[model samples]
Target: MLESWRWYGPYDNIALSEVRHTGASGIVTALHEVPYGDVWTRDAIADRRQEIERAGLKWVMVESLPIHERIKRDDGDLSQLFANYRQSMANLAEQGVNAICYNFMPLLDWTRTDLTAPTRYGGTCLRFEATRMAAFEIHMLEREEAAEDYPADVLEGAKAWFEASGEEERNTLLASIMSGLPGAFDRYDIAGLRKALALYDGIGREQLRVHYKRFLEEVVPAAEDLGVRLCVHPDDPPRDILGLPRIVSNADDIAWIMGAVDSRANGLTLCSGSLGANPANDVPAIARQFGDRIHFAHLRNVAKDADGSFEEAEHLDGDTDMVDLVRALLEEEARRKQEGRADSNIVFRPDHGHEMLMDAERQNPPGYPLIGRMKGLAELRGVIRALA
Candidate 1:
């Protein structure tokens, strides 16, 4: 595996020089300044690549070039959006960046209720509480028929949670759910978010699957032509939220999407944290099964509870078996090498690290504090070296 780190470009609290010191040879990033549905010009790609190269890091993967809402909803002029997407793929390929990671979750990207949940080691980690999310949906955003989405007991739990939360807690929960995260281009207020949810009002899992297949149909060929691998990231939290369907969650979902395009160019990002959030998803098994199709990897662990709550845990100390997972990745790499594939060495980054050390003092993005990720990378590096 080629160790990599995600950089949010020039404005990131952590600089390129800081990333280089982590001993990661590659940088996984995107042209975040470019808006969704807009073409990423070759000039911009070149400039970004130049910047990373100057820091002695190679730009190995585009973390995302977001698929526009217009395209996801099949609303508006999709042809123009598809054209822009194709152009971005071409631009990335032209700059020798092949692996592109993206997600198709509607309304919100990856979400967490608490960005400062306390860890055993006095660090802070991102956390998701199902009851809190339900509270936000039913009592906060007040989405139509939101009560039907949760179990009877869970609904009562959510109601209790909502009633207990004061003004500050409510505001914080609202911001965490509606406001965008680092690299997320969209943000919405309460009314705006409600309006956004209304658009997907009737769209369920089947319809969302259709839209995803249509997305693959439009972009896979272009990706193949440009020699770029389009890796679709799993739905964060790996379940339905805010009354929206989450199409890409489990192994079957991955199989369905991979079968839609049936090309090497159409692939998976294989995010362990997202997939592992649902205990049903066997992280190592998924890694072994889809090893060939995995284009990029986000390796982090989470400690999941029976009540559908989870917190990001130390890299090697959660539900995911880091040893077996890394071993599986190595086996996949060996297979690719034997098959003479050009992208044999997978580019993986330590996904979400706890907020600890000096990182806790800085105004770093949640899950993206510099010292925390460095600790994760160091641990991962040790595992890879030991296994190799």
Candidate 2:
């Protein structure tokens, strides 16, 4: 396995010099400055690669190339957008970066309820609570459809929580729940969120899956031609919220997805934290089952309660058996080697670490603090070394 770290680029606050000392030689990043539907020009890709190389690190995988909403919804001038997407892939491959990661979560990405839930260890971790999220939809966003999506008991609890939470608390919840991943929702507000959600009013699970399948069909050939691995990241909570459908959540979902396009280039990111967020998903089992299809991985763990709530836990101490999961991935690597596969070794990064140590003071893009991730990578490194 090739150890990697995810960097949000120049403004990530943690310097490249600091990144070099973290024991990760490769970086997982994207040209987030580029607009979603526009083509990532070869010059832009080359420039990004140059920046990483100058830092004494290789640009390994694109955490997201970001599939445009038009492509996902099957609307607008999609032919051009799809062409742009392929061009972006070609541009990256031209620059020697092969692996690309993306998520199919419509409109919003990786929604969490709490950005700073205090831990007993004195550090803070990103948290997701069902009631708080329900409250966000029912009260804050004021979506008429969301009321039907959640259960009666859940609705009651969410309503009560909404009534009890103060103005500041409500505002915090609004920001956290609506703040789509790193670059997607920086300036987003409630009106913006509702507008995005309205676009997918009638699109259900099956239709969304159809869109995803078409995406694979159109994009996989380009990836295969370029010797690139295009991996789909799992939904963060791995469940439906705000009436949005999730097609890539569990083992069956993965099976369906991998079945859509049969090629090594069409692959999975295999995020343990995302997969483990759903109690039904056995993380190690998924790794073992889809090991051949996994091109890149995000290694992290989560502590899940009975009520479908979870928070980030130390890499090694969570519902997921980290050592066993790593062992499974390593075994897969050995299998690839035995088969004489060229794209055998996988690049993996420690994801969503607790905001601990010196990181507690600085402002980080929730769950991506410097010290926390370094600690996680160090712990993961120890496991890999011991197993090897």
Candidate 3:
């Protein structure tokens, strides 16, 4: 597992110098300034790669080259959108970026109702409070047929939570919920969001899954030819949010996806925090089963609650068995080495860190506080060293 940090391009307050001091030698980044449905031109890709090289960090993976809403909905001049996608991959390949990490979750990328929940550790951490989320769906956003998804008790809890929350708290919650993950979908306004939702009104979970397969069918062959591995990231929180479908949730979904494309280039990003949000998902088992096709990894853990809510825990503190997971990767890496695969680079980053210490004052992105991620990288580094 190559130790890496996710950088949100040049504008991020966390500089490359800061990243270097944190003991990470690789970077997981993207052309974030580039808009969706456009090509990341060859010159632009080369410039970014050169910038990373100058910082003494290898550009290991692209966090994403975002798939546009039009592509997801199978609409809006897809021929041109797909052509741009192919051209982007070609650009990345030329720049030596082999693994591209992306997701197919419709509309929002990940949702969490609370930005700063009191952790048992006496510091603030990111959380997914169910009640606050319902307040948005049932009373605020008010999507059609939203109530059918929750139980009676859950609905009541949401009401109570909404009634108790102040305007500031509610605003904080909404901001946190809509803050898209790095390189994932953008936040949507009520009208803009509704328009995006309308495109998928008749499309069920199965149809969305098929649409994703079609995307890979069109995209992966080019990826294979260019030696670029297209790594589909799992749905964050691993469930449906805001009446939208999450296709890459569990092992079966991933298996179905791989079966759909049946190509080495179409692979999984293997995010522990995302999959661990669902207690039913056995992360270690999935690692073993699909280890061969796992081109990228986002290693972090989550503490899941019984009512289908969760919070970001320390890298090793969550429900996922870090020991078992790391060991499995070690075994897989050894096998790949024995098989003589040239590009055996498994780009792993410490996903979703706690906001703590000096980072308390810094405007670090949610779940990406510097100190917490530094600690996580050190812990993961130790594990990798011991395995080696």
Candidate 4:
């Protein structure tokens, strides 16, 4: 499953020569002008891998290098942000880039109230509407106990959807849950998300899983001495909003984060639309029980709703089973090529799509447009060519 495509660099407006005509060779990106705890040097990851090898493709996964809110709230000067995230994983393993994708969700990163919702094939997806995110946390980021996190008929249907909405639909649902979309590094406005939800006042969920196990005991041994891998990334509406603390949602929080870092460069980026927007997440049995620590993949599909809403559906039509999650990721890439594993080709992408045809007149980046992810990478390349 090495077909890839998340660009967002070189000022992405869908160009890397139009993502080399969407049959994707590989290019999930990052660098994003290096900011959050800085230092991604090795000449800026070889100048974005020579601009995705001058568009012939293949940058092969970074998708993120972010994790900073003082290393997700272990508070300021976290040893200089864990030594600039272990020198950005030794400057992305000095250039041959090894899968990285990251996320430890704190003050929102991967959320939506509706970036145009509609889809009975008239196309336009991205939703997530638990009472419109509890009417943007009880009347737009007011957030203090936020009506005891909903359920008096979801806080009276979020107070009649915030009094039948007005003020430009509550400022377009507070700029669709505080702006920043494509690979979202940061963005906030209702007084910077109410001072980032008062720095997670009394941080819950076992203190954010002990600050993500002290950020994987200081960046998983510098991503296992630079052979990289590091995946993480879940919790996009997996649970608990505004009150924070969503420690990598489910599959027993990824077996308590692969038993809190017993490495093989500690992995998992299996985002079947963020753990299938939680319908008791069983996306192909968590892709065959964590398919050998799954280093990268985000194949999309959502359609959930037993009250905790969801949307984005057409990567083989939601409630994920995209052909049994692509035949359990092609039987975990034939068990990592029968155990000879040198990361036996993983890279997936086609994560969020459905803004549809001419990407509904492109404004792009909101579940990333480009003809709805080239029709979800041509329906995941015809289900990985009829299941390989």
Candidate 2 per-residue C-alpha lDDT over 176-246 given as tens digits, one digit per residue, 9 for 90 to 100: 87666446435557887777778998899999999999889999999999998999999988998778899
Query: The CA-based lDDT of model 1 is what?
Result: 0.88
Q: Residue-wise lDDT of candidate 3 within 75-186, one digit each (tens)? A: 7568888889999999899878878998998877778877778877666788887767777788767786878877777789988887887988766776787786334346
- Candidate numbers, best TM-score first, in rank order: 1, 2, 3, 4
List pairs with backbone clashes in candidate 4.
Answer: none
Give all TM-scores, in the order shown: 0.97, 0.97, 0.96, 0.33
lDDT of 4 at 371: 82
Writing each residue's lDDT as its tens digit, candidate 4 over 241-319 gives 7888787888998988998878878999988988888888888898798888988888988888777788888888778
Model 3 stretches astray by more than 4 angstroms: 181-186
lDDT of 1 by residue, 1-388 (tens): 9999998886588889988889999999898888788899999999999999998999999988888887778886698889889988998898999889999998678889988889888988899988998898899888768888777877899999989989999989987775444344556777888787788867889988888899899999999888899899999889888888998999999999999989989999989999999999998999999998999989999999887889999999999998899999999999999999999999999998988888977777678999899999999999999999
Off by over 4 Å in 2: 151-153, 181-186
Better of 1 and 4 by TM-score: 1
Tell me model 4's lDDT, rounded to 2 decimals.
Answer: 0.82
Q: lDDT for every model?
A: 0.88, 0.89, 0.85, 0.82
| Candidate 1 least-lDDT 10 residues | 178-187
Better of 2 and 4 by lDDT: 2
Q: Candidate 2 clashing pairs?
A: none
